[model samples]
Target chain A: MKIAIVGSGAIGLYYGALLQRNGHEVAFLMRSDLEVAKRDGVRVIRTDDEFTLDRVAAFGDSEEIGVSDLVIVSIKATANQSLPKMLDPLVDETTQLLTLQNGLGNDQFLKARFPNNKVFGGLCFVCLNRIAPAVVKNFMKGSVSIGPSDGADASEAETLVSVFSEAGVKARFEPDLLGIQWKKLVWNVPFNGLAIAAGGVCTDVIVESPELCSEAKALMEEIMAAANQFGYTFRDGFADYQIEITQPMGPYRPSSMIDFVEGRPVEVEAIWGEPLRQAKAAGVAMPKLEMLYALLKRICK
Target chain B: MKIAIVGSGAIGLYYGALLQRNGHEVAFLMRSDLEVAKRDGVRVIRTDDEFTLDRVAAFGDSEEIGVSDLVIVSIKATANQSLPKMLDPLVDETTQLLTLQNGLGNDQFLKARFPNNKVFGGLCFVCLNRIAPAVVKNFMKGSVSIGPSDGADASEAETLVSVFSEAGVKARFEPDLLGIQWKKLVWNVPFNGLAIAAGGVCTDVIVESPELCSEAKALMEEIMAAANQFGYTFRDGFADYQIEITQPMGPYRPSSMIDFVEGRPVEVEAIWGEPLRQAKAAGVAMPKLEMLYALLKRICK
Candidate 1:
């Protein structure tokens, strides 16, 4: 499979190198940083492994790349508004457009942009950080879930999973990817919102302060309730499970938190603001989530 | 009238100099840093005026002081735990002990410790900072409300108002001193709790984020409701009035906020923890206050 990974940040570079190492043709649709990476190749540093791939293709413009079997969109949530136009050159009838981005409304926007293409919903449950232009450090091991956006046949899902597994990336095919999306949505809206707002680590919030932990939990519960009102059934303890698993990931800060600390634009609208809008539209009372969204919006502004 | 002022910090020195200028025989209860002040006497730099009073007695130990007509206790709230014992020699049966300390539960503790002495509630609404050992800089002019803690005769209240008026301190005597105390209580709990827990300034918390502002307002409202349940009627728009008056006070941080920045022992128990306990006892729900209290306690730990 020929894979083009867009927005060549840490996640993009990590997966692109893995897929390339597995005998698949992987290219990066990158910005100016990729020019240096093209000459020197990409370096990935994981806790369990480290490698430098020198045969990877890098492009500044998506138009420079030819057609591919798959295109993974892994840009920051704040960059999604301009991503569709940037990705126009990479879309074809058989192109599988997968978005493994954080936030709630990216899938809808992607669908609206590429209606004819097979857009898949994806969520990555790992922690990775870009230490340099071409170097990414994977701090934890987690899987990715992907499925057809509009409930299509399972053949494409199986093929994508096989491609990911063959590349040493754990990927699962979910029949109801929306459920997983909402589940991820519930966790991010509260944890990411607070981590950005409070300027601290996750353990500093969850372990040190029971009030903040409980409030964050209540916000997640409200998001889950809002999702249920919209015909989604979240498993019990979904929020607690995410908190438990993510707490041990040593001093890990969410991307939104990192963005705020670095004085960059945040994904308040997608991760928090849009879900709050949807909840209100569905007549579900999400006071905690509403408060978190309003707070994050104010911080972003 | 003879008056002895204990805990000669900024507020303490301000009240002491004011009382001395009002023709009262005033003395300051001095600490180690105030040794120079004890030798040279007290100095006050007011907004409209500045003066220094010589021959004002200063004593390090309360046991060395003579009896007084009034004893003004103007220490920090956290220091109030050992204050009653410190005042053992200066406080007589006729000496009315007025606490100008910030936060709740101080009066109850004072009354408990000095059961036979007259304990009056004093709430100061001014901004003063100690610039030097002998000098206090008054940045704002505000009133002090004083009244009997046990709802006794109005004579003690009248005397307090008269003394404060003569000393150039805007002072009023409220028959329902508990109501005023509760009003101040509501304001301090939310702003102080948030500022301390987040380790930020008041305006930084209130103006930078709508979520923080709303959370603050919710906490204030919960405290107000709890106060009302305890038979106190607060004036309308109290919280808004406090925010308006304090926001432009020129980047002034609350004491609790200062404590967090300085890593000092915070008065979390008095300001937030005790009121939460009172609310629970009064059968009033205070989710926001409880959460804030819990967060501050954890941070302090």
Candidate 2:
């Protein structure tokens, strides 16, 4: 199968390299990393594993990659405005669109942009960063949670999950896209938001501070409450689960915090704004999330 | 009346100089400003008025200032731990203790420490900064809302108000100290809190952004709601009034923001935490204020 990786930042590069290494043809649509990628391909480094996909197809223009079996969109939501132009050249009616973007609205966005294409959203439960152009580092590895967009068949998510699993990613199918998105938000809204809003600290700083830690838990509970109103309830002790899992990340700088401190555009709207909007529209009160969103919209931008 | 100014920062120096100019014997209990104030006295600068006390008393030890008819405490609430040591020398059974500290707990703390002494709280609705060791710049001048702490006579507040008025400082007596504190918090919880939590911004920066400005208003509403539950109600349009009044201060750094940027300890607990605690104790829901307090606790500290 041929796969075109759009928005080839760290997530795109890491997964694309894995798919290519699994004997599937993968093409990366590059920007600043185009030259380096074309010259030496892409590099993926993990704590215990590292691989180089030498001579993989790398394209500066999306048109060069053309239509393929699958097109993965992994751009930061701040740069989502370019999706139409970037994805237009590589997607056809039969091509499935899997958006591995963070937060809400990407799957819906792609679906709106490509009405006839099958849209699936992939939530990467892993920690990855682009250390340098064409070089990606995975500090932690977790499974991908894939779900079909509204009106997309459930089987499509299973197919996409298997596709990811074949490429060595532990992938699972989530029938409720919004549910999984909210589940991801249970973690993202607080950790990512606080990491930036608390003057750009890391997970360890947030976890160590009792005030911040409780606030993080409160934010998670608020997100879960909003999720419940939307028929996406979580099991008991979910907030604790999120916090407990995050403890080992140590001084890990979340992706949004990385974007914030490094002077890049953060995905403020998709990660925070969209969820807040959806919750409020559904008549759910998310005061903490609303405040968090307001702060992020101001400081992160 | 012999007035000794304890915790002589900006507010202390300005008011003490005013009282001294009005023929009152005023002595300032100093820290780093002791030598400069002794040699140069105190300089008070405003938009249209500037004065320098040529031979004011400045003391390194509070004991040197001795007992006074009135002891005005203007220290940052973060340094409340030193209150007993600092105030013990100047405050006596008859020396009325007037605290001009920001937020809720200072008056209560002082009252508890000096059970025999009368305690008054003053909410300074002015913008003043300690520009140098012995210099204070007042960009905006407003009245100090004076009130008596619990168990203190209302006549005591009236006397304190007259004392300030005679010294050329705008003053008004509020019968309810907690009410006035909440009224002041309707501004402080948002403007002062946001100024620091929005990554050390000024009043103008907060007022300029629509999101932040609305957030400021929302925070004021939350505070007002909490105040209402505590039986302290403001007239309608109070939030609007707070926002309108803040607009002209153009880039004015609220004292908390100044403390934040200058690496001085801020009154996070006094300005945010104490109000949050009081409101929560009264079973009032102030989600925005609570979250703002959380962020301030993590960042401002």
Report per-candidate DockQ.
Answer: 0.24, 0.67
Least well predicted 10-residue stretch by lDDT in candidate 1 chain B:
B199-208
* Candidate 2 residue runs with Cα over 4 Å from true position: none
Question: lDDT of all predictions, in order shown?
Answer: 0.76, 0.88
Best by TM-score: 2
A160: Cα error in model 1, Å: 3.4
Query: What tens-digit string does per-residue lDDT give for candidate 1 at B229-291?
Result: 878876799767776776676566666676677676788777787778878898997666655
Question: What lDDT tens digits, residue by residue, belong to model 1 across residues A2-33?
Answer: 88898888789888888889998887988846
For candidate 2, lDDT tens digit of each residue in A1-301?
9999998898999999999998888998888899999888899999998988778798889988898999999878888888899988888889999999988888988999988889999899999889998999998889899989988989878988988899899999998888889899999999999998888899999888887888899899888988998789788899998889899989998999999999999999998999988988988877788778878887876
Looking at candidate 1 chain A, the ten consecutive residues that score lowest on lDDT are A199-208
TM-scores for every candidate against the unseen true structure: 0.85, 0.94
